[model samples]
Target: MPHDVVIIGGGHNGLTAAAYLARAGLDVLLLERDDHLGGAAVSADAFEGVDARLSRYSYLVSLLPKRIIDDLGLDVRLVRRRYSSYTPDPVDPERGLLIDREAGAGPDSMGSLVAAFARVGAEGDADAWNDFYADTARLAETLFPTLTEPLPTRAEARALVGDDAVWASFIDEPLGRTIDARFTSDLVRGVVATDGLIGTFTDLDDPALDANRCFLYHVIGGGTGDWDVPIGGMGAVSGELTRAAREAGAELITGAEVLAVDPDGRVRYRLGEGEGEHEVTAGTLLSNVAPAVLDRLLAVGTADADARAASSAIAPRDQPPFSPDGPLDVPPVVRERLRQLAAPEGAQVKVNLLLTRLPRLRDASVAPEAAFAGTFHINELESQLSSAYATAARGGIPSPLPCEIYCHTLSDPSILSPELAASGAHTLTVFGLHVPHRLLERFSNDELRSQLQAAVLASLNSVLAEPIEQVIATDAAGRPCIETKTTLDLEEALRMPGGNIFHGPLSWPWAEDDASLASPAERWGVATRHPRILRCGSGAVRGGAVSGIGGHNAAMAVLEASVVA
Candidate 1:
């Protein structure tokens, strides 16, 4: 019998969709090209003979909704860090800005900001910080709840924000303008701006306001936008999602490569290293892959006249009837738009280091545990970030790379083995910004990766009291137990076009204009030109981060579409 839904790609979003649909009594089948289930959210022993399970590729959890966790009964635990961020001054290494949630001057929560700002000798800065965040928090509270619902029209969403000034500052204008206007300190402005640049490569002055859209998603996740650490690395989250899907009767198949997908619900896939191809029929197909990937898959059987003519020759005997009523043929204008869509260029380099012990900081007053526990900013001053961005935009890596570091062991040591835990070993994850794919395009993969690794270590050492290289643990072969994945590496490994972690530049979560769409599915923004198929990944509207909003919305789209379901 044909499956009710065939979800391509076994990422967390796909798993979420599968669990929801299967629980609703739909037969769901999930296929992953990789041997592992999680697309980029998997934890693995990156270094040989290392006892640490690093959350390779994408890290941290902020955008995941609590409702999805509760509804799916996922057994993942997210632990919040008291210290939000600690940034060391490049000129005065002894003094740094530490935003501690626990330390405050008053009973009010704004005390944290007051205390942090006071430490930096920036009088009245706390009020500015509070005011700035209060606005974002308001929007987060109002906008986050609407993500699970149908996509609202632009005007409706604006009305929901209810503040013309807030909308103008955040949605209409560049986020940098808002930051510059609100914060007096360059360090503070840079720290806030970093949120807007996560996995996105755009300048603060970008006229398109792409940075603003990214900033909104970063700050508005889960209403509070707190990026908590998963208790047992990212694998724990994916594992629970896998369990949920399986328990709900969704059949997940790994090591299966989906070669083609038809708008009419036909899927062709091949098993591991096998030559014989298999076909499956689904009442509805949900694609958890990126839009570019889905487009390529659809184009496979319809790219040419010969292929289109032979399409019926390869049709399965028991194939379900194909529907021609929906937008089956890609419109010429839409095709041109797809072609013109800017390829997402990832601007971050990820470094996973197995440390013998946490590196000591230059600031003697700040304990190493406290600084390493939260995000440690390095060379991330506003001027530095702008300089680095400008340099990288012109195909040059900045000398002092802007990056942030976090030690997983400080928050959750469950990922480490008993011996490693007792030995005081920790894993440090560093994310360097402004090292876009274009900067590394000049060198071979190996050569550029080596150069990037050297640059990252140098950048880290610039802020530390001692050279970080001396503290790195050596693997069995005596090689440093450190690994780096560049944007190009992610592009090749994860099939992320241009190595973009968000799949593409995030789209505004609402319709631009009030136009009558054929169906509610189109209005929902999860629906594609093909009616039977829907996007359930980071490429979908309001899609990014670890949030399953896209998956939930995609499932809701199918469930609401009586014609498909």
Candidate 2:
């Protein structure tokens, strides 16, 4: 029942792999345990029967390679670029959000962006972002040749990366420290600093914060920060890949779980309902699941490579999606100022209040765009946030963590159906941080509503002075399951080796290194000994963002395996 290639997990990236392989004329089959595919990128009932985005996890598509879009003819319905940013009070008049509503920064405008960076963090963050982009992007842009080039021997890669020492130094330094020494403004710092810690455990205050800066270099800004969802949701990316894979001639199986991947590359799965076992042997196998998942699968084959990665981070039970990451808590009321602060991601779970109308933040002081664009919200200051983080780290809800309220409807009007818009309603993405999943974990699904509602209402009243209890429709709810989960918050969640964003922590040095441990060609995972069979994500390469470079380069290695053979 098998052919060219079989893909595990129907996550967008996995689908992307299937698409490319199938398009290349390889028979492909993708398997997902869920009846509905699209993994984390999905939407469900907001609460009762209303539809809302389940962006509880993995929300933006900032780095999906464009070649995939063009090559596969993706039916992507982009929500369009409507720039919106939050600023301290007294900045904009309409909605307390600064938006380039008119796309105001024309080329000649030299638009106040760099200067604004200076405003946010003195002269450093502005200059840093500028310089960071210029140098890294240059390398990133030109990487296709080598990354996709046939696999070179370990010796070959070393010669290439070994030439760059200064870049190497940049990699050696702790990411957080790099940012601290460079930026003066907390705004700019938070903006750039958040990247380092975004998807991993590198805390902002972790003086060893350079990891964030290293990660900042990895923000493959979707060729300019346009990471977005297609008309449907992130599902579009997976949809297109699935379609392409089928067209290229791959059979995809959903609701089928493969129990093992042997050292010889045999895939074993449940054949039918109440069925025993079915085995499909393929030329090679790939895993998109966490390394821990792979380890157990490959354990059947006793593959050392699989064993190493799995033991490193994935095997542990109880891994949360957002680990070390919890709901954010801060209160402007605490300090009466705009400062960077986050208390806890657990203990005080954040409840998003999707609205039917544009929130009237028109205080004649704040920017209107901030009211509805990209993870928008209301909040408190730094001290409150810090206090919230500390308190939550100890497992207790702060009576009044600040608030984050966002109306996504105004930014992407299409999120609502004709019926919803006609009713003066829009999509809202509210995030509550520092929420302890255990609090809700203890309650029955039915009884949890009041408890969750009361907690948010109390926090909002104390910190935001807004009545959220009335704003949230009791019937509508997004992914309640994902809402209460955090991958790093608890001790048992799957931990990527070293708590790094990539399968493991990656930095410029790794990227700039050659295929060999010694020189240029040796950088990356190019060393001949570095089996392409076990490559990580595309962004796994030293470059940035979650680009498929690692996969691309690894694919080339697989292709090279053919050539070398």
Candidate 3:
């Protein structure tokens, strides 16, 4: 008998769907290609013999909803940092702008922030910053709640936003114009623009407004846009999801590589090495893989079906009954739709480093603890960011490469062993922007990794009192505890096409005005052309970052369809 639901790819999102569907009384089966769960969200010891469990790929948390945590009873703690962010002045290494999270809106509450902005020659930007974020906070409060629910129509979402000015600034026009109009300081503008550029390759002024979409996801997390540090790292988040899935009776199979998927809810896979192919059928199938990956699976399934049809060896009894309501074969329209999606190209360089101690900053006004506790921006002035993007688009690595660094241990030291913690060792995660995946074709992975690593350190050293290389901790094997993953590296390891973190370009959380929301899947924004198959990953609407909105919505869609049936 077919299971009620089958989930492909046991990432956090897949686990989320399994847990919810199983708890709702549906028989759920989840398959993962890797030996372990938590794709890109897992914590591991990147440094050989180091007693550190670094959140290897994706680090900080912001987008996950509390509803998911409470519903699943997940034992997770998200710690907000004291400092929101610190960006050193690109021209003056000794000065920086630091935004304190604890700073309120009252008089004298803005004193320290005002001075910091003044120090960076952004005297009036402190108020601008506050005004800008206040708008985002309102937007977050309005739209964040709609994420786990059905896809609201564009008109509905716009009306819910309520403020005409906020909608016009964020949703109607390019984000660049707003940034330019709101803040005068290039440094301040760049700090604001970073949100739009994170993991997204696009011009801020581009009419496509991809940057606007990226910016929306960034500031709307948790309704406050505070990116908190997860206690025990990202592994704890996935670990809790895994536990919930298992406790809810979701049968999870690791080391199961899915070879093909039929739209009629048939999945063929090989389990581990030396294993024969196994086939399973489900009433509903949820895809946690990238859309491109799903298309490949469908193509493979179609080819396999054709070869079987031409053969006389297979008996009719061996075949699963094809649903008359579903397509008899993988439709050409489905392939064309997937092809039309923007070719995902991740334009960031991720570097994980273990430091013996936090490096001192050139800006003496701010303490090292405060500077590194939150996001530390380097050479990311608005002018510099645009220049870098222009250079990168022309197929050359940007000089004075713009990057951001943050210390996980500063907020939560649980990731390190007690001895390392006592010895003042910390973990620094560096995310370098504007280094697109296409660069891999020009240089080998090793060559690019080396070049990028050097460029990253140089960028960091530019604003440091001392070189960061000196503070890099050594592992047991006498190797530096610095590891880097390029977009190409991410694609090879995580099966993300072009190593795009959002799986592909992110979509608006709501449905378009002309969209057909007739089906439960379409209403939830998880629909593909196939009725039984739905996206439950980053490719789904309101999907991106570490948020399980995709998984949550997909499960809700299935249950809704069941109710209708």
lDDT winner among the candidates? Answer: 3
| TM-score of predicted structure 2 | 0.69
Q: What TM-score would candidate 3 get against the native?
A: 0.95
> lDDT values of the candidates?
0.84, 0.47, 0.90
Q: Cα-based RMSD of the predictions, in order?
A: 4.7, 10.0, 4.4
- Tens digits of lDDT, candidate 2, 1-565: 4455566666555665676677677666677766765554444444556655544333456555666567667676566545534533222223232434343356732345544433433444455655654544543443323544444443343344343542432344565455556655544444444344343333445545445444544443443444455565455555666676677776778767778765555677875578687777665455555454555465544443356458897453322232122222645354322210221122323344555444444353434444456544333333344455566556555445434444445545565567766777655544444444333334544454454455555644442224444444444344231133332322122122211234433443234323233422233353322132343342234323334444444344444455556
lDDT-based ranking: 3, 1, 2
Task: Candidate 3: give its CA RMSD in angstroms.
Answer: 4.4
What TM-score goes with each of the models?
0.92, 0.69, 0.95
Residue-level lDDT of model 3, residues 3-114, one tens digit each, is: 9999999999999999999999999999999999989899998999999999999899999999999999999999989888899997989998888867654568888678
Clashes of 1: 0
| Model 3 residue 364 distance off true place after TM-score fit, in angstroms | 1.2
Top candidate by TM-score:
3
Model 1 C-alpha lDDT per residue in residues 483-565, reported as the tens digit of each score: 99988889888888777889888998887775554575676678787778888999898888888888888888777775553
Per-residue error (Å), model 3, residue 196: 0.5
lDDT, residue 32, model 2: 70
